[model samples]
Target: MDLVQLDIKGISYSQTQTGAYALLLSEIGGSRQLPIVIGAFEAQSIAIALEKDIKPPRPLTHDLFKTFSDSFDITIQKVIIHKLVDGIFYASLICKKGKNEKTIDARTSDAIALALRFKAPIFTYKNILDKAGIQLKTSTSSSQTQSPKSKVETEIKSSFDLKSLSLKDLNKLLEDAVQNEEYEKATQIRDEISKRS
Candidate 1:
């Protein structure tokens, strides 16, 4: 089966799943998007990799892996979402060291995060894409109407009585959220700090 290249479209907080995030990957030349639900840590790691401006005070696990791989002269050539079973996606890292190439199994979310850090392309089989891809509606009329209400709800949830916390307390909460891999909470705390400044 032929492989189709995918690009990271965006990541959004999953409204249906508490503490889960949705990672959207779009076909390079197509409108279909595959949405995979990921954990908060993976979401944060991927987001940090994608956003050049945001840097963690300490290296994340994915960053450490990149550092270690670089030290050993290993390069990630690409990542492939190879399988989907029972609603879970499986991925592999195609790594090169000197003249040797090896494929290593990885979770789909971790593979995508590492792929971004490595500047490697992401691919998936055509069959999988056909099975899971969603065609985006061309019309934006309905979405525009619904967006404001959702945005308001999101703001209310993220605000979370941030006014009562000191700057120092907010910073502490941010650190704790990051350490605990509560990325959504960390984002809220970070936003609160940014607003204060």
Candidate 2:
């Protein structure tokens, strides 16, 4: 199968899954986009890698991997999203050192985070994109949409104040947040509940 080159178009908070994010991979010179749902920490890692100015005080895991690879004179040549099983993506890192190459299996999210840090190009099989890519409507595609890294914040906001809720209500809300997998909200609720305790 021919490999279709991809670029990280954006990353947005998942509308369907709480505490999950949608990482948009756009086919070069094509309309279809591959949306991979990733976790919050992974999303943040990718976002930080994308924005050149925002450096974390500490090296993230991906950064450490990059540094480790650099110390060994290894370079990531590229990343391939090789398989999709049960809605999960599997990727492999194509690494090279002194003419020796290795293919390392990795989760799609982790692969992407490392790819960005390595400045490695990303690709997926044409068949994979054909099987899973979603086409967008005219008005809200690609450039028309806000950056997913930024969109991650706006979609998670709510109006309810945790301070006003009673212990019982707070616990109930915490339960709902966990059930919904809104972990960010759950953390906030958990903190408030902790304070009261």
Candidate 3:
């Protein structure tokens, strides 16, 4: 599968879920964004990495891993959000030591945190992005229908857990999204609805 580069846009505190934050990964040169819900601890670690001036009193777990890798001459080449299952994202860290390279399995959150610390780039399969990412604007796509957004683009929080909602509720959301001209959101709800039936 083709790989799409990603950059951390920001971390958002989930309005509907306690102690849960959304890690927003924006496609490097596109309007699509993938939001993955993460825990508070992982969120804190990623936030700290993004803010260069804010150093912790001591090295956090991710920081310790960075230190250990440096001592062993290991290089974190990049991070890849390799898979998504049941709304959970799976990732891998591409690491290199001397002439040897290895891909280590990791949680999507931790992989992103490490990527930031190492200044490594993040990537995901194009298909995964298509399945999970929300388009932030209308753009020419690869033979796919493009949703038009008005000039005043408001950020829309995606329906994170469609499986949790009853089919009736899912139908309601789909109707609302279509009425609101939220084609991207509607597309997601439609997919979930299709999965059930």
TM-scores for all predictions:
0.71, 0.70, 0.75
Task: For residue 40, give model 1's deviation from the true position in Å.
Answer: 0.3
Q: Worst lDDT window (10 residues) for model 2?
A: 147-156
Worst 10 residues of 3 by lDDT: 150-159
- Per-residue lDDT tens digits for candidate 3, residues 1-197, read 89999998877676666888867788998977777778999999999999999999999999999999999999999999999876678999999999999999999999999999999999999998887766554435678754574222222344356777777776666665544544445556656865775
lDDT of 2 by residue, 44-149 (tens): 9999999999988999999999999999999999999999765668999999999899999999999999999999999999988876665443444456543443
Task: Give the winner by TM-score.
Answer: 3
Give Cα-based local distance difference scores for all models.
0.80, 0.78, 0.80
Candidate 1 per-residue lDDT, tens place, 23-60, comes to 87889999776777799999999999999999999999
Assess the local accuracy of residue 190 in candidate 1 as a C-alpha lDDT between 0 and 100.
55
Candidate 1 residue spans exceeding 4 A from truth: 140-197
What is every candidate's alpha-carbon RMSD to the true fold?
A: 13.2, 12.5, 7.3
